[model samples]
Target chain A: MERQPVQRISKRALTLWRIYGGIQFSILLLISIGLVVATVLWEWPWWITAVAAALLLIDAVVFIWIVPGLRWKRWRYEVTEQDIDLQYGIFIITRTLVPMVRVQHVDTEQGPLLRKFKLSTISISTAATIHKIPALDEREAERLRQSISSLARVAEDDV
Target chain B: MYEPKRLHPISSVINFVKTLKDAALPLLLVFVLNGNIFSGDVDWIPLLIWIGVLFLVLISGVIRWLRFSYWMEEGELRIEYGFIFRKKRYIPVDRIQSLDFSEGIFHRPLNLVKVSVETAGSTGSQNAEAELTAIRREEAKELETLIFQEKSGYVSTGEEADDADIEAAQSPREKVYGMDMKDIVLMAITSGGAGVVLSGVIAFFSQIMDNLPIGKIYDEILDWIQIGVLVVAFTAFVVLLIAYAISIVLTIFRYANFAVYLEADDLIITRGWLEKKQMTIPINRIQGIRIDENLIRQPMGYASVTLISAGGSVLKNDEHQLRMLPMIKKNEIQKVLKMILSDYQMVDEFKQPPSRSKYRYMIRHSWLGFLAAVPVSIFFFPYGLLSISAGIFLVFLGGMAYRDAGWNAYDTQLTLRSRIIIKQTYLMKKHRVQAASGIQTLFQKRADLSSVKLTLTSGGGAAVAQCHYLEEKDVSHILNWYLSSRREEKPAES
Candidate 1:
């Protein structure tokens, strides 16, 4: 296989992803509590509460504990003068190459959550597709965006 | 040309007819909803209201045609239109890409054409910037010449310059390809149009059932079936045959007199019998070429070629315009393609995937069907066990897909062929590809297999061409082939 892109996304992305997972787990916990209350009030079957509890446990383990770490390890990207190379995905590893000439624009976006963590997502757009490197340090994202835009200006082609 | 010109008076009639066609389905439903007029059970109040609405629509069409005016002013195509809103749209001549002309039955009789103004700014929009419902053919040609001169910034110095303009307008177009009646018939017969028509018929019946008294119909059908189930089945068979015949006739009408012509830098396609259409696609706008061979067409040695183009909203509205060669003998594609796009080459020899990948292809295609079959068999018991045949059929299809999956890189061109029911082969240039990717699943990584995918811009969106489950080396080879383009161009430019 070809060598994977060298640069990795910010390590803080793992914590951000885990926090997102925590929010989802909290929602599931609320639903499980509701199921337990229903089992008591309506005298419903006990298995329903048991199933909800098992689902909440699995959700906590998979989303909050496992997926974020593996995803952080898998994500890598490298931007050169000639092209942008991205290696991402957990189970199905995908590596993409977008030539500099085809880069239409680059944008750095930050949501309220990401802003609080001092992180931003940089998206590189071509005429055909958009590739996003999520959760980069705010300053690093700005630097990369400027460099990519300059490189893209140097290389020109028709759509 | 500076003066605002009104279209031929026939435009009002054409506009009325066009509006009527758009509202035909709703009008039909309205008529059917009322009691049968033939049985003298018609509701007069709704009928009167419908007549009043029709009159209003007719008046609006006339007003719209009367208000619409177009002129060339200050290097822009200026159009002022609308009855109530009074909108004025000025499209710069430089932004105008091409002008498409089509003729409906009404326009044909009046010797008029409907001109659509295509602009690059209208890329993702569904409609063109402007349209002239009906204009004299000669007038349309003159307008095209005027716009061309304005775009090229040509100043007419004298009568000699005007003479040259006339000469250029009369330049001969080389006929690249044309479909004869026999091939059109063959294409119509082999097309999957019957299935579409069958589904449409089913949908129409279901819609009618929702509005009408279905219980009464059910009682009548059940009574008929009680007499003889064979009779009911025979009637259904006849309905299917009729639907198939209707679809065949529709296809023949749509594709009749299809011909391709090569203008200076444009591929001009003119097709249709009753409602004629003419589309002009710039040569440079074409990103790649795709050849499709459906199961039936492949066995019959026939295929269709579709041009993957990057611009033109005219193509976005009617995708049929993208089908440069709607139907042709498989062997004739090369001869015809050479006349049009000589840079692209059709490679016969391709590096196929290893034999070991066959089982992977089979599993990829049939796994979902097998999973579904297990649940179905458990639920329906003996009857649902028959669903296993579907999984077996899918496995057979997967074997076909594997047999056909192959890729070849020649010079700057890359051809990737794969199948998912209809076999598609994409011929893309190195520079035309916007992005490329190589994907490997966890299981495939252990097996040292990867899939190569490339994207080409087509009509404001990306068209992806992929070949699944190939050797790791072959996948890298394709990726390297794409990556090498930058290095090769850098030295050449320096």
Candidate 2:
């Protein structure tokens, strides 16, 4: 029951998250631009055009600048012989625990972007839910996976 | 050993009806396209197309019915089915968590039942491993008894499979509890879903009313109700009336013939109107018991009791397994629980957080309520002071939540008490807690308060319960308990 220090996910996750958010904003911006063009072609109301332009500006500022850093700071996890603890949420600050004995499977996934950065995401699955530790170093992810699996095995045997 | 036995021949007729109904939209689409191709000319193509599709559908249904067969072999239900590509399934009898029987409207008159076999492995809505359609009620009952009785080691082999054994197995059971008309009525009146169902009914009717384009009927009704506040009041009253009526009827239909029987180690619950559903959960499979008191029912001294069973799928809520005794009196809860679950003890002494916890709960609750009321009150003008009253009311409710929130640990069990309008006390095995977590936001970190979440496994899935805004030390104690101790075995009587 000795408390282990909660570890923050890699700082590089911030950049990754920002890039992902920017990509999402870009999609919204394109829709806004389309609306502007439609408004001009159809001679739409001035208020409608004003609202669309304002929304586009807000989206760019918030998604590109604010959210990722907040998210990166929020994402923290702790793994021990007993359980996996996660704390993350923007407004409500949700905390979750995944007991080792309940752990069914574990996988280290690396998408194209993550692979380029030498980062892997370790996903832990239980009977009811799945938990993830994103943007870990590849070797670290593998070592954690191994340790978790063995710990899970020991816990399962204990039960 | 694998001599397959087909389901009742009526299964073909059932499948035929099912397939034709399923094919309705496609047939209409084909007819429309055929009309388009011929430009409304008398080509007789649609009639030919309909006949062809009907013949194909009927043939497929018949083929599937003919192919589908299940047999008992080596303690497993081996099923071979499918029309073109043969599919086979083997389900070990012990792996089966529940065997549910539902008599559909058509099957009811024919004395047939649809048996849905569920295992611990399936989690989603389409989780039934195998569904046997159109079996005689007697055969279904016999199958149920054999699977359960043999499972309990009452019989070792299939050699004792005589007709009389099945009949003897069907002997009356001791009814532990049964729902009467009164209980159903109370449950219906206090239910929270009435408003939701009423809104749904209103929305559906409104959609149809909008489509009618019958001009003055709507206007005439609106005129009769008058404008302004009276309209709002009238509408609210009507909605409540309709909602309660619907709720009462739905509750009656759902709880009709509701009864629970204790048969050896299994607790069998059967209910439903047109579809009579039977669910069996072994006593040892239960993980936790929960008692809930609603804002409406609590004042009346009524509460509901439900179990967190490990492997049985509770069909009440898609996510929550509400194996709930709908309208049991709060005072009677302890007695009833003690008799049924055996080891159940209603904990009285609970440790409450300091009065400091009130600031967080009240402020957090009232702040949102105030903000929400602001817009409406400002827009409406004269009734603006009502927001102030609402804000105070919210704070009062929040105070109650803070006051009542408590936790207690004893022997091998832990109890958490919390209120979400409805007061709930969760009693779960302390050692059975699978996971634990604590959350502290920036402010809460400084305040030395954390919300602790404990995850426990139910029969079907993991159920999580949270104790919010407890002192930080308590959270650590809970986390520590998860690792440090060895649990004593439950008492023999249980």
Candidate 3:
């Protein structure tokens, strides 16, 4: 709708999402292994192990392989002096517009993992809602937070 | 007005009652846990502790009342409170939005009123802004006038100017709307309050059941199974009827003599029979208006209008007051709304979804019902076939929803109408929209269908207005409308 937001997030965000997905897939892998061990110990149906293996395969492909790339492809955002436009979501594309005048504040946050990846997430807050743009380059996130906040202050419109 | 003043002496009593109300549950627990007093096996220790706690609570209420003092100093309302912690709050007069006045039974006979300071700064806070439990009516009026004059940059010129200012302040407020007896009765009868009361009654009964010898009763009930079924069903019906009656009476009490008035820039709503309430909402603070028509009311051609305001404290204590025109004939909404908020116009025609979206709506609404029907049909067999009727009804409702769901952008205002159970139409100005979004799922993308949503700031949170399964172009049109307005505002700003 309205030609999705013009700017794309940092390219490394793709690798970051895949890494996050990999961690989740590894957790599921361990769980499936536990199920296989239980199947062996209890002499459970062989199909139980088969189901667990099939689940692990599906999770590995969907989460670690397919979803991250698609998500990275979908994520897009653009900030103008007047408004902030965001378009994201893989299967369900959502395009949002937040007028700069309504923005209350802006913040850039980076956790341990994000810090290691040199990525930061910037959140734009209005009086009633919060919009977050995740996995931007750390410097870009900082710049965006400062620019958005200054623009918000200059906008000076009250609810 | 500058002197640090205490509330009326009756405030101590009001404080005592308020504290006791909050402690009622724990006190009841203590009483119930203590051995049966009727059996003369009462435990003296818990009883003594209870009495001591009650006494302490009473004393603390008095101390709290005694310690509380409020004064206006250097363009701010300064409030000093707390018996031990000694809390102090200074609210700038500029941020003080409005003063809400209400009269409880305690305040009524004594010619006193409770004052709640509604401030712009109270957003996201659970507690309401500063409250004066009980104050003289005249003092409250004077306080309001002082705040008003200070806010408006007018200096009071002794007693004569003060009197004149109060008169100016009390100048005839145009009576915009009033609910008649018939409409109030109809609104109460059709309200969803009965369901809430019925649930409460069931909860209370469950609590009572927990203390009863249910196993014995169950065995006895089983022995009389056939007759017991009829008796239980009849009793349940009677309980429902009773709950419904109680809710109707309560609604009537709450909405008795409800009226709306327009004074300068504020819309004042006053209602209630037992405890009177008066709330003032600045016209500018209103973000949007939501008209709700539940299944019953819609069929009856009735609807309720609620103002989405930006004041957090306005949401506290009986938000029913915010329902500006609680119940009016659907057609009459425009007439009354014109008097209060002339900027909003009712758009009778809307861009309805394409005919192809009808089945989608039906599937969306009835999928869960139909899903449940499968298990019911399997478990109950022949009788369970009737469960299919519920799913059919939902499907029918879904078709109606598809027909009802529509969106219209008229000038600077956007109206989005949608329904699940309660049909709601939100009328919002372009400037008030905090965010707008267009959403398209994989299936909808293939079908060239999308949903459009807009968010408006309401009280401490946000209210979303959405119309689903619209043509993709229609969704884009709304997004463009929202975006274009921002561009339009830019030229004016420069």
Candidate 4:
């Protein structure tokens, strides 16, 4: 049998996605501040007010920038003719490999946001794990879905 | 064919009586508390009411005791039960998971044991279930042996090979993993801090009225104490902290001697010092594995393993659908996991983390939780500082949630790791997933990100594990993986 080459996933739109996430996190921070102010005005103790506000601010900043950076650093996935390879982590990187023959089903879904953006999410489910690709354009998602389904169908016949 | 022995019919009454005795304390307490709270004018009436209720309960219990009867006919286990409503449930011999025989301290004198047969059913309708309160010990053992032999035979014949094949195909039994007593003790001792705190609060409130100083200038003194409440509050806080620690210690002591064993295709767990329970889980029924690392366990390199199963019965107190393994070291996880799942391989080598952009949706996910907390805090403002504190906690929790969101997928496997205080990694195989779903809220649509969920079946039912927000190209790749066909089996690689 010929050994297959490892395929790497695309990283084209990741930076834009990260920036959007940061903006959403900033909005959360604003909401947290509003909550703290409302609480402090309602006769809460200064210590409680201070702690809550600080935690929320810390949380928002961490969510916006730090978390996304960690995730991006960890995310790596590859698909071959016989198997799929996924590697990801922020601090503790982990790798997993699943054979093509084990796939039980495949599905594609679009939420309101993805719909507006003309994007869809693809999900691959095996007996043990559910792997996903998020934010693909409509045509790309559909094409990938067709290819995977064909592959899965062929795999099923062999099983 | 072996002749099936007939069980003594009187055992049903004894079991019903035992059940009544176990239920009596709570029922009596409810009546007493209600009487004390309601009917202050006539105390004797309340006493009479209690007597009347007790008398009725006794009569009903006796009737139920007389009504229950079970027998094994051919390859079927049959039970005729109920007092007012008669029910007959017949279960085939093959459907029985295990027939358990137990003897209470009281039943020992009578040489009697209780017999319970468990089956694979998620609805928890105890249809193929029967409890023989006090049957002869010899008879109980005979029944157990009969069921065990049947199971052993079925297993030997490769009928139970769905589970056994996984174990046999993967590795040797010695190489399979499981937890020891030390791990169980560590898990119980360090894991239940929140439960300890909650129990302390309940204990304090229950005894609060007894401790309060009543009469004359009590109201005046209370007012003064409220003014200097900060000092008093500090003292109270210290006391509560001590109480919490004690409760935690007591809880650990009470739960000592816990053990988990991986025997062939079964995961057997035994725990509790006073009221010991033995639970046997079939490997095939395990829906998924959840590896959780809390702040306390992370430092020790320990992670708790929880098995998600649809067949197990619910515990009486909490509605937790998953059974926790308590604590095990990260390095030891693979060994223990192999015992439960023989065919699955553990990917021990670390790969480079995914690009940072994968976390964008996690931050967005946290905002939804924060958004929900704002209005709730405003509505409960009258509770003063407590309500405000709760609001703050929610926002903090949401922030922590963002820090925890991340996903990792390998060739045919995917793992979604997330947490706030308690971290969890959901592991599954791509080919075994039964369904996939994509969802997005209106706001998420504008962000061009959507949530992808995949459903996988274990035994009879399914579970959906998800990843939120990824780029369009990534979604396509994942979908392609799912739709991709299986390849022929290659030579096994170590």
Candidate 5:
């Protein structure tokens, strides 16, 4: 039997993800400060305290400067006859594949942050793990859901 | 046909009494702790309080005994229970995974048995989905037979028909495999005592440390001991390790009589020393099978088989699934696998995805443990250097663990192999997998990678057999295989 060629899907909303990174970086900065304060309260060495502070600064810089740029560069997905493929990476390129036949269920969720941005996250669950694609517009997420469900139903075998 | 019968009305009261008895040890410990804290002298008030609580509990037990009622109607098992807020649970006969009948030495003379019915639903409740505290042995057997017949898709014939089915089902007791005295001895000899002793030592030291003054005195003693303490501590650690090994061996010997047997379609594992336990796992609901060989077992040519099921709420220490076979010869693996999967071939080796450097990402990410450990360990331990050394060891192990994790797939079969100290390889078939998911974190997207995880439903729970950080192409290929199979037109057979 002839097998159909695999197709790729665009993982848009990379721009929105860059914004999320800034928020996360701010949270990390607060956490780093908390750690430093905890170390002082515990009467640990002052140098160790300095190290914690330095680490926090480094983390903050990565999130604000490097992370947004990296997010913009990475994030895309594709669909083929047999499976769904997602590829994203800034420095270290990584790809993940999910076979349609193995999909147990699919869900679409919108957080307050994403809702404000008019975006939704598409979640696909298999037996062992759950996968998600973040920051898609409602129309795009709906379309993806319908296509994936139809594909999953088509691939299901009578065992 | 054996018709369903109601349990004796007093069964619920008996169940409540059993629960109270089980709680006695903990309750006593709590009372002792409270007495110590209060430093009371000849406290009659505490004794009076205990008496009052016991009297209340006895009254509640009696009320429950009067309220509980259960009966089998058609193919459904109905249980009505509760004292103030009455609750009823209706279970379909087919949904019953196993109907276990157990009788303790005390109950044996009375001809009473405890019937525990395990179901697949996860209600997050410890109470057996359905339990009859005390029933006649014959009646329990009759109920078990009826449930089994219903699960097997056979029509129930009232009492007479049921008798015939029971006769057919009852295989010779001699044919069943059970632990003898010798087997228990061997198990004890092989199971080292190191784990038990180490846990005990840790617990003892932690208790001592908790009570000790942590201010200046503790620091002075720790500092004075630090120079020569590492060597002495190391020697003491080694001795404790040896003691642990011996204890494990003793424990295994005590439990050596362990044996598993096939009774019809059920797998029965019976073992224990002072307190004996017999657990049964039904074959049909078994989701996945795992074969494990520790360094000792591997050399001994023995392997343990665990069955991942959907219903077992309790997790075994050795493995997550129900241990169907504690110890069996390696050669017997294929035969046992065949019994589980009659039609499928046992694939020993299969093609795995080409190595991806993404593993390095996992290794790097694991250093985050050191991030948490460094601060906490330094504050808690007076021997800060030793704590730091332990943290380094953790980071090294974490990196190796990430690198050791790998996945392989062939046709409709996939196997995930991982190891740190103990090796575990999960084998699953495509049809057995209930779900598949692909995930991409913000960082993974930048790395051009996504993680894929596959799950299979087992007896009482689900087993995630394979997880990997794979290239997008490979992930798509696997996903396509799963999706394409779903499209194929075929008659459904369950």
Candidate 6:
């Protein structure tokens, strides 16, 4: 068996994640503001509002300034004739292997954000779960899905 | 065979009981509101209203029974049923996945059976795509046989074809195991259903409490709760004990006459007292067999065997991933495993984690318990020494988890024994394993340790077995176990 070659998601994924992170932080900011208002008007515990604001600040910093870069660096995937391996997560660094024979089907998807960046996400489904290869170039995503399905069929036939 | 047939008249009664069971919660709520909140007196107006409601429900039940008709037409089982609105569904005999025969208390006296029809793609409230509330047992049997005969003709490739071979073997009908009273008690006490049943018991009792003379008694008990601390603790302990006893009794009655038999290429599991459920799972469709032991069961040296079957024998939300043996002695686990699935056997030697892995395991397992103790320790700072003992005990539990956690790969099936609060020993075949991987955490990487995870395709979901804090090389070996199978033998047929 050859050593499985691992590949990373598109570099543009970092920019897309930044935008996604910005949206998330805005929601958190709104919730934090509401908590502050409740604390002032309703005479809620000062500590409650303080804790909420502190947590939101930490979250915003991590999401807007840190996580996207770390997540992009950590996300690596390899699809072989035998299996699909996905390595992800910042703190955990999880490596998951999905055997080709168990692959029921594969699909390439695009949302407004991903489509805008010329990137697509491919989801590989088995009987139980859907494993995703996120943010590949549109053409590359299609090619991967085609090759994976063909390989999966061959594996299925062998079984 | 082309002629349509109606459900037995007894089906109206069964449907009535079903409606009552479904409407039980609302009925109880209404009764409680009328009795307690509305007025103290029980008057004729409410009684008349209740009677009228029952009459309407009974009429609907009768209408449903009158409308429902099924028959074999064009070699397909065509069923048409509706009270106000009618729809028809025809299922090809070859596509019928499994035919289940059940007899609740209502159907038992009449010698009638409830038939549930499952297909390859059944996604509904109840897993069964279609059901016949009441039919003759012999008629259900004939229908099942007829479908099987037709199904075998076209579906004779994998599992169904193997059943054809087992037809010759069916005559003997070997009795594999039967649960005795001792085993029943052991299983009942060890059953994890206590949590689910306990809540149900509380709900039932609370509803009863609202209307009964026991209301004043519960009020006095609540008065005692105002005393707080020791009273609360004592009450909680008593309630827990009562719940445990009730759950055990419930389990014993539920699995009263548990028995297993191998007929052809299918294993037949029969259990329950009030509601007898008979399920037949094709042996070939079984994706994996698991020997599971939770916290309570493990301490008593008992483990249960559950089968994971794909694309067949679905009943009630669960029972599809049915328990083959509820509780057997830990030592007897391997014996039972071999008896049921012969291609694999248990191993005496397991791949143990490194000695230092114990410390990591202790920290990982005990952190939550430790965090919980922090509050108690803070609140009772003047007598905070009381909380230190709990912390120490939790630490000891973590050590025990480390002692328990290990892995063993025997031929193709990997048996992993891992402990958190609950000690679970999971077994899965290499081929059945859908995925496997190894991860190295920042701490683990620095310590030259890695964790392994194995994912198996379970009934409608994925079950994962993971071992944390192992030698990097060992973790890698665990990852490759699925891909490197050399002795992956098919389970021996009975």
Best by DockQ: 3
Error of 1 at B188 (Å): 0.8
The segments of candidate 4 whose C-alpha lies over 4 angstroms from its true place after superposition are A1-159, B1-42, B100-114, B122-127, B131-137, B148-185, B196-255, B312-324, B346-400, B456-463, B486-494
Q: What is the DockQ of each candidate?
A: 0.56, 0.28, 0.57, 0.05, 0.18, 0.45
| Candidate 2 residue lDDT tens string, B225-262 | 55645876887688879888888888788778888877
Flag the better candidate by DockQ, 2 or 6. 6
Which candidate gets the maximum lDDT versus the true structure?
Answer: 1
Error of 3 at B488 (Å): 3.3
| Pairs that clash in candidate 2 | B309-B459, B310-B458, B310-B459, B311-B459
Residues B310-423 of candidate 6: C-alpha lDDT, one tens digit per residue: 543363357523888887887876766676677656555778888988878777766776787788779877567577677677778788877777888756778787776677
**Candidate 3 colliding pairs:** none
* Model 3 chain B lowest lDDT segment of ten: B485-494
lDDT for each residue of candidate 4 in A1-159, tens digit (9 for 90 to 100): 012224323343255456567777777667767777887689666776677678767866676657666665546555655565565545433344455555656688987656766777777766445677665567777887776666664332111
Q: What is the C-alpha lDDT of each candidate?
A: 0.87, 0.74, 0.87, 0.57, 0.61, 0.75
For all candidates in order, state the fraction of native interface contacts they contain: 0.68, 0.35, 0.69, 0.07, 0.21, 0.51
Q: lDDT by residue for model 1 over B355-461, one digit each (tens)?
A: 98999999999999999999999999998999999999999999999999999998889999999889999999888888999999999899999999999988778
Decide which is better by TM-score, 2 or 6: 6
Residue-level lDDT tens digits of model 5 in B146-198: 67777677867565354667788666432244545654554455554566677
- Scoring model 4 with DockQ, what do you get? 0.05
- Residue B274's lDDT within candidate 6 is 89
**Candidate 5, residue A32: how far the Cα is off, in Å:** 11
Which candidate do you rate higher for DockQ, 3 or 6?
Answer: 3
Error of 1 at A33 (Å): 3.5
lDDT tens per residue, model 3, B1-494: 78899999889888899989998888887887786789999999889988998899889888988999998877788999998799998887878889999999999999999999987742333433798899999888888888888788875645334566678766689999999999999999999999999999898778777989878888887677768878879988999999999999999998998999999888999999989999999887888999999988988999999998877575655568789988999999899988888889988999999999999999999999999999999998998999999999999999999999999997788999999989999998888888999999999999999999899887777889999999999999998888785665532211
Clash pairs detected, candidate 1: none
Model 5 score (lDDT): 0.61
Superposition error at A136 for model 5 (Å):
2.4
